[model samples]
Target: MTTAPGSTRNETAAIGDGLRGNAEELLRELAGPAARLRDDQWVAIEALVVDKRRALVVQRTGWGKSAVYFIAAKLLRARGRGPTVIVSPLLALMRNQVAAARRAGVVAATINSGNVTEWDEIHRQVASGAVDVLLVSPERLNNPDFRDQVLPRLAADAGLVVIDEAHCVSDWGHDFRPDYRRIRTLIADLGTDVPVLATTATANDRVVTDVAGQIGTDTLVLRGSLDRESLHLSVVRFDDAVERTTWLSGHLDELPGSGIVYTLTVAGAHDLADVLTSHGHRVAAYTGQTDPAEREMLETALLDNEVKALIATSALGMGFDKPDLGFVVHVGAPSSPISYYQQVGRAGRATERAEVVLLPGPEDTRIWSYFASVAFPREHVVRSVLEALDYERPQSTAALEPLVELNRSRLDMVLKVLDVDGAVRRVRGGWLATGQPWTYDADRYERLDAARTAEQQAMLDYQQTTGCRMEFLRRQLDDPALIGAAPGSGACGRCDSCTGIHRDTTVDTEAVAATRARLDRPGFDLAARKQWPTGMAKLGISLSGKITEGAETGRVLGRLNSLGWGRRLRPVLDGPDAPVPDEVVQACIPVLREWDWTVRPTAVLALESPDHPVLTTSLAERLADIGRLRNLGTLYLRPDHPPVSAVNSAHRVAALYDSWEVPDLSRTDGPILLVDTLTDSGWTFTVAAWTLRRAGAPAVLPFALATPT
Candidate 1:
């Protein structure tokens, strides 16, 4: 739970030609920021400057997460601190750090995106000790060309390396970058003595340990509560977007800080920004397609409070900070709950009360469908890409695309698909492919597929839940419990989930009339679940034993089979022929029926699906009832974040779990409680459950704790 703040993790330096003898004093004299270091910062500051070994300090955002880099640079500039290089996943973040360092009167420059003449000058300054930190994106450092151009030419192999957004290194991280995996080799190429400092805000234990391994550095993961207590989490569910937008406009006037309106698509972001602007809200529109300067200007305006709100896509946040942000409202469901958590986290950075809101629409399905279509590669395409690689040195997604006669967009989709499937990984963009991509075992794929399915179920649950959306998310993450419930609020309030906002079950009688009006969808607006205003109930079971939780694969085939009910299980197995055994099903049938009533139909339907291979004995073994809770990052390859697994486990163990909660867990009262437990494998899932408890709900909470490693 404790890790060194991003600071000194290395201790070797060769002074600028003539200054070796007095480097320490000279470096200290040059480093001066006497006022900002309050008593609170002293602990982190001293921990970093006092030694050149490992240490971790978790301070809130705006408290100077960047200052740690400056201090480290000063130490490195001193005789003993280490020659340094910082690899960040976010270019903006790196720029911010470099800017901060230079502002502190410390010389700093970057070797990314732009040309070499500048890099060479910066390199000279670094070697001469005029510049203390050389900031680069993993793209530049991992580039064989970039490395060849710079590494040997530097003063010495950088003795200190800091990876900002360290979570990217973990395959399980929310923001996984293939290039990050190659960092281990870069570190190896740098020599073993170099101590690496890794920093990130969203990582859990799994991410923390994975990062340590990836960087080959003793980890310093400084963790705090996943819950941003100052932030009040809420969601708005509406019959349609018209209702959503109109309601949002009204809420915007009441919220103190300017709000962030998140849309699922770039076009949606543009339209919403325009609409809000027309309504007299000086709104800034942001998305990936935006020009850098424009994005900068708009973001600056928003941060400066010059505007009342900003309407953008999810691309607006990550690796950037806006502490004054008061609220974030999603217009629709994101592809995954993890995406939701990140967007919501952007708000409430200020010390005052903040709110996170969600407004889901039926069109969310279209959004998800689009994401799935583009984000993941088709199976045949994957086969083809791997086949194409059979002869060539691994190529870029573009090169492989034409050979397979696919378009760039299609090719990119396939690549992303394979990445999540872990079937093929372009770890260093183009340089690092899984050495044996074809060797990916069927069992592993099935296991991962099952994990994804469970995650999807959790998302659906949050979308459809009728209670507090925030609380539902937390409970699924298995946070400790909040108990002692009081009574429920009777008013519908402004949220979409209130029964007042929607109609009860309908008959087919209105189909013709609804069709005449070109009404949204013919069937139930399943996504309507996000509107429930009150909190949630908590209950889920975690399967134990037969698998080492913290290991590379935390699967329990035996239990999975037992639950499948005496039938052939087609788990996404690794290797050529890891099919489900017949004998395993016989043992599972009796257990399946006795397990939970809702479990049978879903399990059967899942078995009939094309992706049934994901259902192994332990794959869907965990099951729990939907408690007032929320969850995410549960199914990733991260072992540090346990709440995600419990949700997945709950899906496997639950009597019934559905995507039907509305205004999930906003009200209802009880002592906040979360279920903290682990799988037989020693990986932990924490946080989300507790966040759910805080939102509201009174029910049994459970998490399958990992056995101690």
Candidate 2:
């Protein structure tokens, strides 16, 4: 870090005094970046080198996580021990760390494939015991020769092992690199009785725990709250792409400074760049393929203010530092909030107020009947990967590829993929990446991402939740580190909430939304819905109740008779001859109402006496559930039904309410509950809420449980 004549020495001494003259002096003596370390950073380094505890220094992107390891290495070296080995993921980051180490007079060398001729230097540094830290990718850890020779020697003197961006160990991380599993094995084999330091800017509880478990770190947790007070968050709704583009064009010159526009896909980056360029905004696109020159151009342009914004995927921010990113925009939904955060974090680097806009399309959903067939490989992949791991030996991608029945080539391809994009290198002969690529059933491997689609769908659902975006993200990350004030609450005055420009007046749009909220409260009806099992139960068991072609009259009557529910709706689940208890059937009723049936109108719209003692408290919940119900494909009462995609289907479904028995008016006065499941029909919520209010309910509180969407 730059300093006046002796500011480096002064800062070093001050930091040493703060750390009681532990590792701080060594770290400061070797500091090289022009960007001086902040006080908190020194504390973090002290925590690492002084306490000698495995540390995780969680910070926003570009906050200099690499420096922590570099500083730690010097102290380790000063102890007359060997240099620490940093198992880094990104090549650019590795290159940068190596250079920074050399500049600071620390013996640092990397063994990436980019420099095959440097092996002599690498071997010399290793044998000479002159290096302070040997930077290697996870793949390098698997090399038998290196592990047997170079690593063993280093391990004898090793004092610390650092795993950067440790979240890849968790499936919840943005890019789950499978090669990460081998890291623990590598650490164990290295004989480095050193504290393990794992660090990442964005990780939830699950990721942190998973990393700790994988890396064998102690129980100490390093957590940073997810609140970036400097960043503003907003969501814009659009049903038309053209309209979205037009709206985005209007904001092309936001904040009049450097910023980033992150897209879900590479094509999106190019297209958005083109669009912004057309709108007279100085923009450049940076995807995985952006050359070093182009990357340099983008980085320099941003720092020089030559370009107002960088239209790119999430890859543009690594290895570069620009303190003043004015804003960030998302043209499409991010793969996950983790992806969203890392990309959005590019802006507001200067700790200045910044803006982030998330645009979503509101659509009416009509189930195509095929959604049920969607494939999910969560259980299968987890099972396969675990089984495939050679728990005793290294988990070689090559050896494990053929054992799986799925597409071997694609399986191997996906299995060897590393996290955070290019963090894991392919060792020259390591079974994981350098071995012969497997060949097998191409179909299975071809659709690996397809298998993860279910997870993505679940992610999409969370993104659309209307609770609190911060809470949902926290849950997904499962990292308790993110539990604090709700994000985007406008407390910072920079967020969209504070600005009021993106305030969702549409949340409680229905006239009786408050009534809907009341109906959502717990009561007998509400409890009944809770008892219902998901549709995955066995065939007949999965059926909630029978639906009689165009009507459910006899079915309800029979069930009620069977359980004596009709005898008296007074909480009767005690039938003597009933195979299922009266309470069982009673509890199953609300859930049964939700089951899809073969009858034209598979579900019967039935309501209980809301004012009744048993029903009074549960009234709002039942009504809210009903309001959230999807139109399900409409049943055709008329002999001649319109095509599946016709207006008549919508009309007939909307009119079904006219034929319900025992309509629970009080239930109609509740917030909609079931709407969360219907991604395709967020707008149907409005229509249903409007219909319910007209039917007489207290109020309709149609909140989607705020999410990152």
Instruction: Give the residue spans of candidate 2 off by over 4 A.
Output: 1-47, 62-64, 95-107, 113-120, 143-149, 291-304, 317-320, 361-409, 414-492, 503-709
What are the per-residue Cα lDDT tens digits for candidate 2 across 1-709?
2222445767755655655344445445545323566665666666655455566666667566766777767766776666787877766567667767876578778876556689777878778776677888766665567756776776666777888777765655665666566666656665524666777877765566667666654635655555566677777766544455556666666454777776655545665576667557788888877875567567667778898888776666444455577787876666456666766776776756777777653321211112223222344552454455442355444344334433333445445543222323334343322222333334654454453454456446644555545445545554344446455331434444445556332322232333222222211111111112122122123222222112111112111111122223213322222122344334334544543433322112222221222321232234334444422221122333222221121222333322232234453333222212111222223334334445553333322111111
Query: What local lDDT score does residue 64 receive in model 2, on the 0 to 100 scale?
Result: 61
lDDT of 1 by residue, 1-709 (tens): 1233463333222222122233233334434423334443333434344434443333334444555656655655564544577787655565566666666566667876644568767766776766667787776654555556666554255756777766677655667776566566566665444555666655544556667666545645454334455666555566645445656655677777787888877756755665565556677778878876677787778778988887887767665667678877788777566556666767776656676676777666655654554433345656766666532255665445435534455555455545444455553345234545444355644654555456566777877777755545444333222222321222223334533354222323343233222211111100101111111122322323242211111112221111111012223222233333444434333333342221122110011112223332122232212222223212222233222222122222222222112234444333222222222312222122222333343421222211211
Query: On a 0 to 1 TM-score scale, where does candidate 2 land against the true structure?
Result: 0.54
lDDT, each prediction: 0.49, 0.51
Q: What's each prediction's TM-score?
A: 0.57, 0.54
- Superposed by TM-score, candidate 1 places the C-alpha of residue 22 at a distance from the truth, in angstroms, of 18
